[model samples]
Structures are given as structure tokens and as C-alpha cells.
Target chain A: MQEKELIPYLYRTEFRKITAVLCRLFGIEHITIAEDIVGDTFLLAAETWGLKGIPANPAAWLYVVAKNKARDFLKRNTIFNEKVSPEVQYSAGESHEIEVDLSPTNINDSQLQMMFAICYPGIPPESQIGLSLRILCSFSIDEIADAFLTNKETINKRLYRAKEKLKQDKVKIEMPSGSEISDRIETVLTTLYLLFNEGYYSASRNTVLTKDLCLEAMRLTHMLTENKNTDKPEVNALLALMCFHASRFEARIDKNGELILYEDQDISLWNKELIKQGECYLNRAAKGDLISRYHLEAAIAYWHTAERDSPEKWEKVLSLYNRLLMVEYSPIAALNRTYALAKVYGNKAAIIEAEKLGLDHSHLYHILLGELYATVDTQKAIRHFTAASKLTKTSADRNVIRKKIDKLKK
Target chain B: MKEFVMVYRSELMGEIKLTAEGNMVVSKEWENWMGGIAAQNKLVSPGMRLGNEGRVIKPGNVVTNGPYAEIKEIIGGLSIFKADSIEEATEWAKTCPILNAGGNVEIRDIIQVNG
Candidate 1:
């Protein structure tokens, strides 16, 4: 491959590995420093390779540079030397060369540790995701801002506060043990779920679907499944849910990048491989006694991947949504469940349930109301669509809602 | 053929705040542009990135902090390539990947004094 193409592929695959290893060595308290060092290593690689061409083993070259950078940091900074050097010496030896353990096992272990560190309960869910995207996923602050549908300054501040909290709490970069692991995994899974949803149902105007974020979430979740300690049924269920959702990615957006509703989407575009994988995970998830929210959601997602216009699929989806609401009481889930209610039952019954929920403030509620009222009361549907258009922040959403209003008027 | 030096200038070079992924994309673009020049066998020098920290020596053997304190743009790096004329060199400089990062390239012909 060309150096241009190869560098990005390596960056996507190796950047986190290097960062995770360095974070383990320097400790989570100095994560930013580790990130900087890794960033510099890549920059140096680009500069050197542009001139001398790519080395025989580029991955090894990166490791060597990273090691040198770590050594240089330890030697130059008295604070780092005093704090980190002794720990290194105690772990390995007193040799002048700083031996960082970047072995395959250690790399995986470090990533698991970093995942736990990022998902620490002390940090808020949003901030946890911000840190995960920034540290683990290697997303720039600007990119995170775009994902959040906010400004760079806001994202920067959120990341700063999250990292500061980590430092203040002295959050160790290690996997939780036994009983604590279950609770900690919930936080990690929740963060991953949010990350996936952000990509799947992205609010950004420029890009309707952020596929990379979804892929990143799946990649991280797969890591959890690889480790025996974290391969819980819920983790597998979440992976199944992500896979099912990702399988529909190609069908989700049109040539113009407009949103395609589930019913309107072309079924042929759905990825059969990902759907099959989702089924495998869902089947595996059924082994555990605990039926978590992810289990219900995965079942709901599984129904989504079914053949179009199947009444049985709608029935299964509606039942799963009911169970999901009972297990986890979220307004968003309730709103979504009402949509499935419309599919299984009638629009009138769904409208009654949706109205009872008192979600007038949510654009989704208005949009759902608009869709339900389309066939029955065109005027009411138009009003709901107009309300939804006003409530939405992005032009893309507004345009979709406006099109609905225009169709209702006709 | 005449040799020309392409000087990359940008404010981003001063701090280097890009994330690893972002840097990779930028570096990849650089690699492609440089690789193209290499393919044509016109690349003279792949160039060196200037460090942020440096000192300047004046005529009286006096040294001071270099590159000026208040300049918005910093000389990021340089590359040399052979072309038939300044126009051809300018055409090549126009495609420099530095432009993607909101940077500009300054092309200067390398004078051959003893050739």
C-alpha cells in the first residue's frame, strides 16, 4: 500500500494501542502527556518516512520511537523521573533503557484497563464518552464537538473537566475485580451504547450518519468480549444490538444523505453478514439468567433486521419494547416503544399512548405525532410537523420534517 | 532543470495540537504529495521540519530568541524539487499537502552558484 494510505490505517489500528501502553507506563494521571508523546511519534514517522520511505517493519519502528520518546521524557522531566521512573525500575530493572511492556497480552490488558479508566463512575456519562472518544478512539476535540452537535470550546472544557476528575479521584488504570466489575461494566457498556447511538442517529447537519463512531463503539465492545472477565451476557447483547443497527447503516441514508425511515428503507441494502453476527451474539446472550436492558434492546434490534412487512416482526418488536421500558424506564425508550406500538397496533392507539407520555418538548414526539396523524387528521399532522421542524436544531432534520408537512398539506 | 524550495507556513505548526488520527490524515496527504514528486524523480530534498525553539545570531555575534515573538505564521518545514522553470515549480508547490491544514507554501528558486 502507498505510505499515505498505510499511515492512516496504522493510525486507526496502532494509535490506541500505543496510547494505551504509554498510559499504563506513565499512569492515567499523565494521559495527556502520553497522548502527546504518541502523537509526536506518528508525526516523526510521517516526516522520516516521507524522506527515507517506509521502514521494513513500520509497527516496530513506531514502538522504537515511542520507547525513545518515553526515555527522553523520563530523562528530561524531573517530576516525571521522580514519579514514574521509580515505578518503572521497580517493575522491570535499573537498566538505563526504559523497558515498556508492549507485548500482545499487555497491549490487550492495557486497553481493557484504559476502558475501565475512561468509564470510571466518577465522571458523568457524557464526559465518559468524551474521554473515550478523545483518548481511546483518538477523535479530535473538533470531531467530538461535531458528534455532540456542540462547539469545540464546549468539548474542550468537557474533556478538561473529565480528565481533571480522573486525576482528582486518582482513578487507577486497572480492571475492576469480582463484584465491582459488574457495576463498572454497566458504565462502560452505557458509554459504548451512547457512542453508537450518536453515530447511528447522528444530529450533525453536515453528516447525517457518523459511521466511524458506530464502528469505534463496536470495536471497543468487541475488546470486552475478548477478555474472559468482561465477556458478560450484557456485553454480548450490546454487541448484538450494535451489529444489528450497523447492518442497517447502508439502508439508513439515501444517495442525498437524507434519513430513511425503517419502513421506507430498501431491505436489499442491509448487510447479511452483520445481521448473522448479531444473531450469533443474541443467541450467546440468552445463556445468562439476568435479562438486562441490552438483552431486550438486542432482541428489539434483531426484529428490525427481519424481512420487511412482516406482522410477526412488528409484534416481536413491540413486545421487546414493552419489556425494555419495564426493565429500564427511559423517556427516549418509551418514545421509541410508541413507534413500535404504532407498527403492531394502530396509529390511533399509538397516538393516545404517545400523547399520554407528555413528551411535547421532544422533536421526536412531535415527528411521531405528525406521522400518526398523517392519514387521519392532515391539519393536525401539519401542525405537529411544523412544531417538530421548529424544535429540531439541524437543517437536515428540519428539511425532513418540512417535507412531511408538505406531504400532509397535499 | 532548476531546483526550488517549498516552505510550509502555518500557525498550527507552532503548537501541534492535532490528535493522532488527525495527524495521520495530514501526514498521509503529505506522503502522497511527496511520493508523487518522488515518482517523477524530481525530488531534490524531502526537507526538515523546523523546531519551535530556536535562537538567532546577529552580525555583532549577539544571539537572541529567533523567528520573532509576535509572528502569526511559523515556517513549518521545507522541501526541494527540480522543475523546468519557476512556473513548473509553482505548479508543484500548489499541490503541497500543507495547504490542507490552512497553511501556504512559499516557493523560492535555489540559485546554483558553482554549477
Candidate 2:
């Protein structure tokens, strides 16, 4: 990369690494400081690199600069400065050199610890998502606001309050041990799941930014699958679910950035490697009889990615959705179950079930109704499509509904 | 300990217009600096970062742009610090990160006034 291009590129990859290590060094309460030092390192690089040109080894240069800033912060402000308050002694052995270890092992450990800390159950789910985006994903305040469709002040306030709550409660930045791991990991996994959905299904207009959010969520989930404390059937299941969904990321959107319905999508655009990875993780997740929602969802998604069109694929999908609803009840999941029902059974049987849902407000509900009614009652289908077109928020959804109306008119 | 306000002002000399990416990283540094003081338990009030552009409402009902006739240096922010004396406060002010960014901090003792 050229000198001007390198800063943003490094910011994307190294921001989380440096911040995690600094949080590990300074303690999670001082995360604002950790983030600050990381930002300063990048800012200084931008300023200096502009004047002096880029360093030969920019990433290493950043690490060294960040370490020095961390040390500088400690020496001037914290307990290390015995001169400021003579009676108080430095307890953490400020006598020894402050080690800002950025080694791969330390970095990974720190990031893992930091991830669990951000997902602490004490924090609200909204705050958890915000913290994950800022720290784990290294999204700037503005970028975060854009993704969530909020302003900078709200994001800043949410992050500040979350960190303060962590400090007040004195939550440790470490992995849970023994049985506690099960509960804690569940929270972490749930947070990651919400984060992925936020990225995948967010109403934000910026498709690229939303995709980044999903990919970042996947990265964090993958981290859990590797750690011993969190290495569970459910974690792998969640990873598999994410992988299966991500595999269709390209196929889901057309060249014009419009959403593509499942049957119409170009299967060739689907990522083969990601689908393979999903299969591997799904197999690993099969060993346990846990039967988490993620395992069921992942199985359903895997079926959707089958190479050839077959009724058997829809049958598998239908059964999994049935199991998933029994495992946990969600209206959206119930709605999805109806779609799979349409695929396995005749539209008449599916239409009978879909009407029971009575999800009048959802544009998706009307769209599904419109589809089911197409063969039985064309007039009803046109009316439902008109209703859906009015309710749909995005032009893409409206576009599909409009086409359906036009087809019925013809 | 005495209470003093450190007013940060900067001409922001040779301020190169930062790219959007560069702009993203700047706010955190300010937060880090303020949080440092608060962590020390010396921060009386975590002061507000002032706006660069403002309109001064004059004695009349008329409004005008610019806080001053000829504005150059900007008052970046203000925060109260607890230290033993003006000298100590000034010493702490010397370490303010704003100074590194072409800014200076003016330390002044807060006088007790009867309401």
C-alpha cells in the first residue's frame, strides 16, 4: 500500500489488537485510556507519516509507539508516579519495567478476555453491541452511529456509560472457570448472534458498512470456537450458522445493491469455501446432544446452500424449522417456518398455516401471503402485494412487490 | 488541595486538514486525556470541549457571527483540577496533551464568591 493508504488499512487490522493489549495492560476500567493511546498512536502516525513519509515497517512502528504511549501514560498519571503522592506506594511493582506485551499469544489472550468482558451479562444488550463494534471491531464513533443509524453523541454516551458500569462493578477481564463458563459463554454467544444479525439485517443504507459489521461478528465468534473455556458445541454451531449465512453474502445482493430473493439468486456467486467450513463446524457441533437454536438454524441454512435444487432440501429445511420453533419460540422464526412449509407442502396447506400467524404489520408477512395466494386466488394475491408494497421500507422490497403486482395484472 | 481551572487554547498551527480516516482517531485522544485526570481523582469537573465557531449575542437583540472580532486561537476545552497550588496546577497543565497539539493551558485560581 502507498503511504496515504497504509494508515486506514492498518487502522482496520491493528486497532483492535493494540486496544486489547492496552486494556490488558492498563486494566479494563481504563479502557478509555487504552482506546485513547491507540487513537493517539494512529493520529501521530497520520501527522508524522504525512510529513516524514511512511515508515518501512509501519505496523511494528505503531506497536512500538503504542507501547511507549502506554508507558508514558502510566508514568505521568497512575500509581507509578510516587512523587505525586508520596504516602501511597505503587502496588503492582512499578519498579519493574511496564511490559506492554504485544506478542501473538498475549494479543490473542487479551482479545479473548476483552471479548468476554464486553459481553458481560450486567451490561444491557444494546450496550454490548455498541461496545463490541467500538472495541472488538475498531469502528469509529461516527461509523458506529452510521451503522446503527444514530448520531455520534448517542454512541459516545452509550459507550461511556457501559464502561463506567463495568468499572463500578469491577468486572474482571478474564475467562470464566468451570460451570460458570457455560452461563457466561451463553451470554457471549447471544451477544455475538445479535451483533451478526445487526450487521446482516440492519436497516442501515450502507451495505458495505453493514457487511463489515457481520464479518466482524463472525471473527469474534470464531475466536470463541478456538478458546478452551468457550469451545462448546453451541459455539461451533453459532459459527457454522454465521458461516452458512456469510457464504451467500455475495449472492444475496445484485450488482445494483438490491436484495435478491432466494430462488432468484445466482448460486454460482455463493462462496464454496465458506459452505465447506460451515459443513465442518456443523459436524463438530453434532457430537453433543445440546440441540441449541444455533444448531437447528445452522442445519436449516446448510440445506439452503445445497448445490442442486431438490424437494429433499426443502424437506430438511422444514423439519429443522419445526425443531427450532419447538426449541424456542419466535414470531419471525414461525413466519420462516411457514415459508419452508410452502416449499415442502402445497401452497394451500402453507397458506392455511401462514394465515394463522396474522402478522399484518410486517411487509414480509404480506409478501408471503401474496405468494401463497398467487395460485389459489389471483385477486387476493394482487391485493396482498399492494399492501406489501405500501408497508415495505426499502426500495428493494418494494421493487419485488411491485413486480408481483404487475405480473398479476398481466 | 486547591481548585483551579485549566483553559486550553490553541492556534492549531500548521493544522493540516485530516482525511476522514485521520479525523476518526482524534476524539479518543481527548477522551483518554480527560479520563486520565479523572482516574487520578484530581478532576473536579470533567469540563466540556468548546466549539470552534460560535455567535456572540450582543447587548442588543441583534445576533452576529464569530465570538470575537478577529478570532485566531481557539479555546479547545476547560476542566477544573485539584492541586496544592497554582505552581502544581501549572505543572499538571504542562502535561496536558493539548500542548503537544499546538495548544496551551492557562491555570487560574477560582475565588470563593458569596451568593
Candidate 3:
């Protein structure tokens, strides 16, 4: 397989977890040095494994290479040159029998800690994710900029300023306690959710599917599960939510790279294993009495994945949305739920509910309302489709809306 | 082993906007400027940014309102270069973004006190 095709299989989430752990153990300062070693290690794996057949333990092989490389770097830079103070104990002659546990840092145990350390509630939430992506995920400054759809210079300034604040506040890599963890969890979850959406949205054209983003969120959620002190009911709910949504990754896009709406998607193409995993996570979440927005969203996705996955179950989906609305009211989510209601109940009800949504800023809500109007009230629908067509910036989307207008007129 | 500093300021206002094609151009320019110097291990650091509006503190307890001199003629970013002479530093700065916009290059010498 080409490197692009093999990337999803080779450097999976497990490798990222291992990398995170290794980075934490060896110190964040050694991140670049360690990453260089890891990069070379992957290159060697591509050459060796591609020819000699896959190794029994690929991650272990990569881990060993990373550790050895780290040791070599420390020897050359710190021990031999004495660049760092000699007090730093990087002794060369350690016992060969002893094994080093170069596991990646578990965000599960330390996500709250990492969050509080990075997110002081003073800096904007966008900047918090900017720092997290850098410090936690080890993304390059340019990579974060691409993710944010902004220039590298803007991202660089945000990261520099964020790091300065972290230094000024003297934030440590440890878990937060009590109410602080709860508050910080919001930022951490929001960042992860946004990260997942960016991946799901798959903004970059060449990379139609960024499994890395999904894997990153799953790895972070796994960290939450592992950390005894940091694990919360909401974390479990989020994990379930991610798993349920991720189950449909294969069916989300067509072979031609066109967007496949959920109603038209091939249900059989959904990953049953991921659905099973999501179920397990949902069960784990049920242990706690506290219900979260993740739980509600996951429940709705579970319903869609459960049976026929037809438009028939729109009522059930609407009920789940109502439940979600009770927990946290989002205009976007409400718009989605209203669409479901329109399908099950009728167009008039959907239009009435959607009109009250106050989503004047969103082009999508207008489009959805227009589509509904086309069926029940053609004149009103034409007006809406025209308004929506005018409101959108993307010519591609507007072209679709124009087609819809033509169909409605005919 | 004297280090020379080459400060590159964008001559055009909002002209440094990098499109996909522009990025390809700028990245190539960046590589030629930095990598050419880095081959000799003399490129200390390369930094670039447009102008920002902030208070400029001057001597005699004076504060200037804005990016100082001219908005169009503001300094974007600079590189603290480690080269043999001002000629080499000027040569390096010659390949800067300004050449594309018909702008000039400024090269400064670093004075050592201890040596």
C-alpha cells in the first residue's frame, strides 16, 4: 500500500499514546529531539517492515528505537558535552537488564491537570486549544495554524503568548483537584470535541479522512479512563459519543469525495466494532447518575445505528435532541433536531420550530428551512432558498442550493 | 566568527498575504534565504511577521502613538544572522521579500563587548 493508505494502519492511536508517554517521561524539552528519533524510526519501519513482513509488535519496536535515540541524544548533548548541569543524572552505565517504561503520558489521569496548567480561564478558549495541541499532541505551530484556518504567524503569536502565561503562572504537569477539575474539564472536552469536528469535517481536500483527529480524541479519552483520580462520568459519555460517531466514518463520504448526507449513507458500511465499543462505553457511563450532553448525543447516534437507520425514527431522534436541549441549549443542535421533527411530524411544525431558533447568522439553518418549505410551501421555500443561496460564501454549496431551487420550481 | 544581523521589513502594506501559490513562492524564498545560510551553520534564527499597533517607548519618558514612523514602511521581522561580514549579511537580506516589491534591505553589525 502507498504510505498515504498505510498511514491510518501503521501510525495508529497506540503509537501516539506511546509517543505522548515517552515525551512526558523524557521531558517536554526533549520533544523535538525525541520526535526526530521517532520520525526516523517510522521511516526505518517503512523500509524494514514493508520488505521483511510486519513485526509482531510494531509499537514496541518503535518504542525501543525512540528510547535508544533519546539516550543517544542525552549522551551527546547533556552527558558528554555537559551542556546541562552535571547534576542532571543521565548516567551512561546503567544496568542492561533493567527496562525503561517509555509509555506516553496518559491524558486521562492528567488531562484535568494539563487543562488547568494550560487553561487559566483568563486566556481565550481558542488559545487554550492552540497550546494543548502544541504541548499535549506535539503538533507543529504551522499544523495548528492549518487546523485553525489561519496563518502560521497568528498561531505562533497565540502559542508564544500562551506559553509565556504558563511560565508566568508556573503551571505544572499535574492533575487538578475538586471543583477546578470539573471547570477545566469543560475546556478540555470542548477542545477535544472541536478537534474531533475538525477531523470529521476533514477541511483539507487531499486528506478527505483525517483519522488522526479521531484517534487523538480516542487516545485522550483513554487517558481519562486510565486515570483513577481524573475519570468523570462526562468523560465516559464523551468517549461513547466519539465511538458512536466514529462508527460511521466509512459511510460518511462517497468514493467521489462528495458529501454523503446521513439519510443517504450505507448503514452496513458502519463499523460494528466501533458501535460495540460505544455500547460498552455507554454502559460504563450509565454507572454514574449524572447525565451529560455527550450521553444524550451518543444516545441519539446509537438509535440511528441501532435498527433500520431510516427517516422513520426521526421522532426518536427528536426526543434525544429534546433531552440534549434540556442539558445544554445550542442553536446548531436545535436546528438539527428541528429538521428531524420536520421529517417525522410535518414541514409546518419544523418551519415553526426552525423560525424560532434565532439562527440568522447561520446559512445552514436557512438552507434546511428552505428545503422544508420546498415540499409544503413552494413560494416560501423559493424565498428561503434564494436568501440562503445569497447568504452562503461557498460557491459549491450555493450551486447545490440553486439546483434545489430549480427542482422546487419544476 | 562575527555575527551579522539582517532585519527584513516588508515594504508593502498587507502585500505579504500568502495564497497557496504565494505560499509555494514564499516557502521557496524562505528556504533559499535560510537554508542557503544554514548550510554554513551561520543562520542563528529566522523570524518574520507584519506590523502590529503598540506603544513605542522612547528615551526622555516619551511614548509614541502607533507603529512609529510609517505604517507602510514598518519593519515586519528580522533575523539575527551569524556571518563573517556586513557584505554577506546584506547578500542574505538581498533575497528577502522586499526584492519582490522593489524595496531596500537593511544590514546591521553586532558589536561584541567581552572580546
Residues A190-299 of candidate 3 have per-residue lDDT tens digits of 77777777777655543433565666767777677766755787788888889989998889767755556777789899999999999988888776556678888878
**lDDT (Cα, tens digit) per residue for candidate 1, span A162-209:** 888999998899889978999999899999999998888887654533
DockQ of the two-chain complex in candidate 1: 0.00
Whole-model lDDT values for every prediction: 0.82, 0.81, 0.66
Per-residue alpha-carbon lDDT of model 2 for B20-99, expressed as tens digits? 44331234345434433443345687566665466768676978775444567767667787777788677667767887
Model 1 global lDDT (CA atoms, 0 to 1): 0.82
Residue B22's lDDT within candidate 1 is 38
Model 1 iRMS (Å) reads 27.1
Docking class of 1: incorrect
Which sections of candidate 2 miss by over 4 Å? A79-96, A307-309, B1-115
In the range B7-39, model 3's lDDT, one tens digit per residue, is 666544553455443331244345433533443
Best-to-worst lDDT order: 1, 2, 3
Clashes of each: 0, 0, 7
In model 3, the Cα lDDT at residue A213 comes to 61
